[model samples]
Target: MNTCFSSYRSLFPVLGDYVHLASCSQGAIAQPISKAIEEYHASLLSVGTNWEESILKVEATRKKFAEFINAEPDEIAIVASASDAISAVATTLSYHHTKNRISLTDLEFPTAGHIWFAQKHHGADVSFIRSQNGMLPLEQYEKEVTECTLLTFISHVSYHNGFTQNLKKISNIVHHKGSLLFVDAYQSSGQVPIDVREMNIDMLCTGTRKYMLGIPGVAFLYIKKELAEQLQPRHTGWFGQEDKAKFDIYNSIYAYGAKRFETGTPCFISIYAAYEALKLLLNVGVEHIHSYLQDLGKFTREFGIANGLKVATPTASSMYSGMTPFFIDEASKVEKKLKEKRILVSSRKDVIRIAPHFYNTKEELEYAINELVQLVK
Candidate 1:
């Protein structure tokens, strides 16, 4: 156990009550997040109009997120949800009638899948490369990617199986075929160390509600600086305009970079909450957090296997994130028993998912394992 991680558990206030091994779905809110939101709301109530101040705050938040993900501030766009962000990026791609094939993985979230599917109605071909035993096969993707392929959309981590895709390798393949790579990073953003520049991800979308430890209805998209200028906005709003403050003018051009994707007035409260959440994550450091999560994941997997429970996630610790999926014979019964015992865990079909954050303690992990062992027996 590292000394850095030993002190990491002291930061979160929520560890006192429940074990909270579900940060993959929704992270535990830190005290700083609560304070930040309250202060922002108080400002709104006291000062009636502070658009300039609000913009500054929002830009600061974007810069923090960009720095965390190794991207430029100009490349980041604050949106409502991962779906909204992905939709904006997907619609912006240059899709012609002839070269209209959009490649996607079968394991993609519904939001990303639907965006590409809608293109089929517009005479574009949508192709899905199936995952081999919960892993995206590079060979399958290579076979489907053609000169006609306009975009290849994939999830950085599969939501159900917790299998991580090598984005850098995949992006190279897509770029070589002259196609854009759009990544749904909802599962991997905060939990894993990501660098957009190194990965060569053309576009990426992630929500703040989950591992980001924020309120819902706030998300962001990252578009490569070079590619941002090439795509056209499909659903443009006043905020997307170059002169967003010019209300008197009916006509205005969309701004450059990822801001061109902003559809309308954003949820200010949600953004404020997201800002606080991101700040906490930044302070803790993503690399350190990822290393801690890997330990938790390894513990959960090894414990499950030792106790005769089925391990569903990848066995390789390096490839795994905080998310640990396992199963007992009667998953529903086990879930109910665990919940009744105040041992929180979620079930997806037959697999029980356990995702612990940096704040969670080894005691909590042991308690969860004990409860699971009792239920299995």
Candidate 2:
């Protein structure tokens, strides 16, 4: 654990003044990200433009992303946002044009829910497996995934309650009924270690802004190699073509692999930043990061309950995660007070969320909790 801390700590520049506990919303900007962007800008200004160098840098970025997620480099495609990634994959699924139903959890993010909902206009049936108090029941999901279900879309981690769903179990259940599992991994990707091959995820999409520690405009999508050929690109541009730079007017064949998802001009700046951010996380090691996060979550949960604050996340270490949601009578007031104390936390509905990353120390958690105890009192 000490070794993990030492390695992980090196990736983040110390923000000594503030105790940042909002990694679920947005991660802190790493120094490497800033330096990478500066170097990229300088490259743009140098010489009579080096197209090959630019493409190689972008490819290297994709390789870094692939390594981070344990995916093939060719299976990754850079996109504008999580929504774009979802829409690209969701719209391409041939089931969207059919009358087959789509299953999703009630606690899904708006982007995941809306993308599936939009397909209803085209004659698809979308059903949300009702979650009990934002907690998804495995049996309920099993019951809802029927023969008519063409796709099952779910958030790997609930943004509101911080519940991490069992994707492997859910995928198996869905696949048995001839349905594909499309996961919105935005909340869980960077903080958690995800292996798509091990989980049998047909399609997964996530943005870099949150735990990924990148700028907001960058995201990526992973399509299982087998499913890539089945998806008919609904939104395609020159970038998706067999030869992106080719000016041929007649031939129109989409590129193989995930590159087919990208539509037009890429957000090069965000991509560059995201690449560096992913590289930093990869160096830190995902398993180490996850263990550190689990410890942080445990510490936060214990401290919150020891005080007067009501703990909203599961008390068990196995069930809970880095995101811990707590509650106080006056959530708004508590949030304001914490902000004044240079402690950051987000309020969702009646619950106050304190999500910290690997870099955050136990001492910081104690400080935040102490402040919360005072606010609640």
Candidate 3:
């Protein structure tokens, strides 16, 4: 056991009974989450409406998440979901005028692309770059991005196959073309390290549910400082106003920074759970987690290759994350087979996806691989 991550194992007692390799679909719930939920319920039962404590914890979690991504606290906004977060950012932009094209990839999760695609009614020209073999080549972005391109939207890590893209290169191209870059890090945050400043990301959205070790109904959005301070979102409420407590009907002064992007009251329980998850995941640190997953990816990739399994993820070892989707006939049935053996994974289309977190042990991976070797063909 890695002493650095051994502390996490005790928190996640559920892993002892099952070989859980589906962290991408939903992360494992542990002691911290249970305790956080218990505390949330206790507070509701006692005070019922005292939101000051919960609000403070949300702010603290924002700072911690900012630290994880090397971003400023004010740049982060707590959102209801990734779809809402990206949509809020979308509402702030001008799509009717010059540079009306929105460039995105087919590899992105539906949540990320749906928001942009819906903009077609508003005269936003959306172009989707298709992937040839479960991975979008960087050149695809070059082909998609043009002078008329207003923004380049892509996933930091693909959900289906766990292919991590080169953000710096994409960001550079987007900037050189005088366009903005938005990254959906739903499959990357906590499992990978990111520096928004270094990567030149204009905006980024991710939820605490997937890979962040929390439940649904809560997410965070990082809008670059300038955009957060300047651009005004079309959809917002009192929570986004400069003086939310004042209750002034006439005045509509949006708050500066990411706070302005917020709409209404947040899910307090979800916020509490997300805060706790960030604390636990940050303990292992993203750099260490990322490095550990890379090694595990190498192991899984080799195991998959040796077993005559078809790979849907990146062939290059360095680009792999915790997720390794093997192409299997009747993947849903194959997943059922693994489930019969007390292993947990996910199936998308014909691909069986396995995502192991830092808490997962090598023996568990080997055991899962052994079972898969028989079931894959």
RMSD of each: 2.2, 2.3, 1.7
Model 2: residue 8 alpha-carbon error in angstroms:
5.1
Q: What tens digits encode model 1's per-residue C-alpha lDDT throughout 1-377?
A: 34466665555676666677877677878777778778778887899766776777788888988998999988988898888887786666666876788989888877777777876766668888887777767797788899998888888887777888889999988999988898889988888889999999888999987788888878999999888877678877887777787884767687888888887878777777888888888888889888888887888888878888888875643467788888667676787788777776766777878888777766788789878887777
Winner of 2 and 3 under lDDT: 3
Candidate 2 lDDT, 230-333, residue by residue in tens: 66798888877779778787888878888878788777777789888988888777788888898888888888888867887654436566999897676767
The residue-by-residue lDDT of candidate 3 on 26-76, one tens digit each, is 888889887998898998899887589988887888898898788998898
User: Any runs in candidate 3 off by more than 4 Å, and if so which?
Assistant: 1-4
In model 3, residue pairs whose N, Cα or C atoms come closer than 3 Å (at least 3 residues apart or on different chains), thus clashing, are none
Model 3 is weakest, by summed lDDT over 10 consecutive residues, at 1-10
Sort the candidates on lDDT, descending order: 3, 2, 1
Model 3: lDDT to the true structure: 0.85
- Native-structure RMSD, model 1: 2.2
Cα miss at 71, model 1 (Å)? 1.0
**Candidates sorted by TM-score, best first:** 3, 1, 2
Which of 2 and 3 is the better model by TM-score? Answer: 3
